[model samples]
Target: MSNHTALSTQLQHTGIIDAAKAQQLQTAASPWWLQILLGIAAWIASVLIIGSFLGPLLALADNNPVRTVAAVALLAAAIWLTTRKQEFLQQMAVAIALAGQGLLVYVIYDVSGSNDETARYACAVIAILLLLSPLNQLHQRASLSIALLCLLSLVSSAPLLAVVSSLLAIVAALLWCSRLKWAGFAQAATIKSLLEVITLAALALTLFGQCLLWLDTGYWLDNRLDMARALYSALGSVLLISTVFWLSRLATVPSRLALLTIAVVLCILLYPASGLLVSTALMLACFYGCSRNWYALCLLSMLLAISQFYYSLELNLLHKSGILALSGVTLLAAWLLLQRYQRRLV
Candidate 1:
């Protein structure tokens, strides 16, 4: 506190900043609870405002054309509001955008006769549009991304889910890996925000895929689920191998080979529980790209992966235990060898 005051005083004395600006800078921020309360109030107000006109419009909601037009109008309003300089307007915009998106999706589902595939495609299109739209608010983008994930998961086929999960994984890998290269670009912050959203969606999708194992639908469904799991495992292994290969480019030739060997071994051992591979690859990518403040996220992902891997049904308890134990031992040995190699290099 004293240092900050001294620095402020120095800046003020040096005429770098005026007294009013320095005083403003030194003002304390709002309390967390106050901020939360404000957000809740804004949401309630927005909801009520939307409800005011929606009551009469409810009759026309059944008409696909009317609902579509209304949704587009609301989305357009949201986009405009988001560009305003007011915080309250931005908060309201999120609510309006969500309502608009929900209505649009409802229309899609209604038009498709409740077909999951059609709804999923509609969600993909909406998500893409949201990404391209001028709505760069993190909260808005994250909410829509989550909504897309949830809607896609609802009644979606296992094969479709697996494919979406793979695509998200690939996108996350590419974004995180190349984040630093684009750091100086005008849209770097936007890219980073998108990366965060994609990473979260990827993690959630991986969870959904892993949890599908416990769903005991009919025999035919079981066969389809097995195929999806196998497909994910193949893709995840390739992704993990590619990630390790990318990371190894900075190492010596022998170290690169060692790292690739370790990655391949991990993929083979954890092949049955492919969620582990996906989560591990994501964690490593996050740590490599943005380790400064992402340690907690990486740790959370690893913990989730470990817990999921433990309960996974692809292997029996004894087999799973053996694989885990062997993996730990192998990793320990590799770390020790790497330490020795580093000493030799030094």
Candidate 2:
């Protein structure tokens, strides 16, 4: 802590940071709970402000095209407001933008004759645009990406969506794990935010896939979905292999092969349990990536995976218990192997 303070002081002395900026940096920010409360208060204020004018706006518009135009204008204004330096304006901008998005979706639905598919596609495009543009802040990007994945699930078949999401997770995990390699680049901050958004979306889609399987959704297990399920599982295995190889990139060939071998073994053991395989890969990604902020998410994913294993319909309780025991033993062995390698290096 003293080192950090000294460094900051030196940086300020060197004129790398202005005095005001340095002071701002040195000051402790509000607690997380207080920040949340402030944000909620800001949102409530924005909502009430919007609501007060919304009725009159609707009365004046009264038609889909006019409402769509109004919604677009509102979104544009909200985006512009976000670029302002004031914290309150930024908070209000997020709420206003969300409200604009809801209004836009409603208008789209009405314009397209209540076509759900069209609305989903439109919203997905908007989400992708927001993710790609600098107009959105970090939290907005994360929320928009999650919304994008949800839109995808609505438009595509469950099995195919599962495969797409697994592949997305792998790519996102690799990007996140390699973040330090390109940290010196000018685009690093943008890339970091983008990867964070993608990582969140991947986690969300993984959980969505798990829920479908856990609920035994009729659409997920229909006769026509057999081939799709097979494809999903096959692609999932490949993705798991790729994730393991990437996470072990710094290791020797023998070590990489050993990790891959363990991953493949787990893949085979967890074949009937699709979500657990992907969740494990994601958890490994978080762990090896040293993503401290995402540690809670990784823990949650693992807990859900374990619960999914316990409730899997493919295996009876005795078989599930045995497989889980074996899984625990396998993980322990892997941990020991890794420790041995670490000790050798030390």
Candidate 3:
């Protein structure tokens, strides 16, 4: 949402589309179960096999000199091997990097509490490693995902700092995507890759973390975990406003009266979905898609957002129906108004 206005206003001023051309999509891959099998194996090893087991086995020693040195050396070796290989060992590189990050995290958790007593400082160091990933392969993307996971892991413990850093990272990603001029080396792949990681992290947290409980329960709201949801919603509301203005007024009457009417209807959406982290994620994804002219993303985001609303346990059927009706009508009116504006311009 921070970057949405900049791009949207630019698009309106210039009759150009820095967008992907339309083409039918197709996919071909090996058995889905096999792919899942490999992924599960890799993830388990990263989180348990080498990550937890070997990390603790080494930490049993009284000192970290050997363990730290070995971790660094292994990471260096993995990067070297990954870059040197002619064949893309994407899985191998990703697994090794994950293992390294987990080991560093473990060291920070175990030793930092006793020494400097600043575990967060070690977390920051690990974050830097993920950001400065040495492998010039797809492993870089995996590093971004791990980095996002690290951020999410810190959210409940350090709500303000983690949310601020995640916001800054998303802003940086948008700026990078904007710089990828047509036919650039990586095009928008880097931007998309970065966003994908962030999106998945947000989804995971909202779906499985304290976010669900926060949304589904209102008995207690004084915890730090709830702080994360509030912060996210506050930021996401900016995009919601921007989008409402763009669709209903900017391209229409552009008058105070028109703006007032639109805001009144948009209020319906605010109360029902504002506090939920998943709702924020959906809207942010929608705004991101609209800003970047990613049609497929927009459609997918819309469906996900709708489904989330339909499946919400926080609101009863009657309230859900009201919210859905209001949302649907608001969008319908905005769409009709936008179509009219387009016709007038034509």
Best by lDDT: 1
Supply the global lDDT for candidate 2: 0.71
User: Of models 2 and 3, which has the larger TM-score?
Assistant: 2
Query: What is the Cα root-mean-square deviation between model 1 and the actual structure?
Result: 5.0
The predicted structure with the larger TM-score, 1 or 2, is 2
Judging by lDDT, tell me the better candidate of 1 and 3: 1
Off by over 4 Å in 3: 1-63, 85-88, 113-124, 157-192, 202-234, 243-264, 275-316
Instruction: Sort the predicted structures by lDDT, highest score first.
Output: 1, 2, 3
Please write out the lDDT profile of model 3 over residues 73-170, one tens digit for every residue.
65765676566533334455667665666666666667766543245556556645655555643666666665554544454443563355446434
Q: Highest TM-score, which number?
A: 2
What C-alpha lDDT does candidate 3 achieve relative to the native structure?
0.52
State which candidate, 1 or 2, has the greater lDDT.
1
RMSD of each: 5.0, 3.5, 9.3
Show the colliding residue pairs in model 2: none
Candidate 1 clashing pairs? none
Residue 264 in model 2: shift from native, Å? 2.4
lDDT of 1 at 152: 58
Ranking by TM-score: 2, 1, 3
lDDT of each: 0.77, 0.71, 0.52
User: What lDDT, from 0 to 1, does candidate 1 have?
Assistant: 0.77
Worst 10 residues of 2 by lDDT: 220-229
